[model samples]
Target: MIYYQWGYYLTKQQILDLYKTWGGKFGRFNPHDLTDIFHARRSIFHYLMPGPVRVWIAGNDAGDGVLFFVGKPNCPIRESVEPDLAERCLAMFGGPPCPFTLVPNTGGEAYIMKRKGKLYKMDLIQFMQSDTKGDQYPLSLDEILPEQMHLLGL
Candidate 1:
């Protein structure tokens, strides 16, 4: 039948790179392209593994989350998504013995807004962390003024 299906999918490296704040405008950009890349399968993954599964769309905040199902029933997960479902999907994929898959979000802008639901965005982890941390490690250099450096060690 050639049915076309597209949903939330991202490589672990893409997720990791976004976590590093390589993206912009709500951390929206391809993670793999960034120099900061984490090695993974580069493909073969979904928040909830495809197959009689449920997919949810969550924002960066706690109370702001929604759900969306992607399997047979095609419903949503509405209880503040935990790894429980992901674990279940893992089990379905042949347990821990089964191999893993990796895929990147590329740029959240395009996919993040797909059929809004009540759950955290896959990139939420990175978005919040970057705001607090500011992408890379904050240089202590900024903490000390130009004159303060020579005086302290001088």
Candidate 2:
């Protein structure tokens, strides 16, 4: 099955570094140290599998991002999602149907939300850096913009 996993706050350099370290073989989507927020809870499944893996990453003009991981069929990391989980993610982020939209942070939590024609993200880093919270978390799409010009080298 195909597991579509999404991520945020990661730079292209970091991904390339991981790709090189892993010898182009995809493995667990371990959260990065700099990952201030955005949690993909399903990532736990990745630890249960071991094999050659494929991973794809994407991001918006902001620093927010997405990742697509295809695991071996019947494996723990393979595509497996529950309707209830999807519902909770959608309700919290308020976007179109997504396979995964959670991102991890330091101590707190954060997520991405879309409204009108714009896309915005909330992250714990923002809170620490700017002392923002709740509705304020969704207020700054510009707050978390990355200095990197590209994402996942694309």
- Measured by TM-score, the strongest candidate is 2
Give the residue spans of candidate 1 off by over 4 A: 1-14, 18-74, 78-85, 88-154
Residue 102 C-alpha lDDT in model 1: 16
| Per-residue C-alpha lDDT of model 2 across residues 12-108, encoded as one tens digit per residue | 4444343434343222334352232222211311321232222223444555333322222233322333444334433433433322333444232
- Once fitted onto the true fold, the runs of candidate 2 whose alpha carbons sit more than 4 angstroms away are 1-10, 24-57, 61-66, 69-154
**Per-residue lDDT tens digits of candidate 1, residues 93-131?**
333211111124444321232333332233332321121
TM-score of each predicted structure versus truth: 0.20, 0.23
Weakest lDDT window of 10 consecutive positions for candidate 1: 35-44
Pick out the ten consecutive residues of candidate 2 with the lowest summed lDDT.
128-137
**Candidate-wise lDDT, in order:** 0.30, 0.33
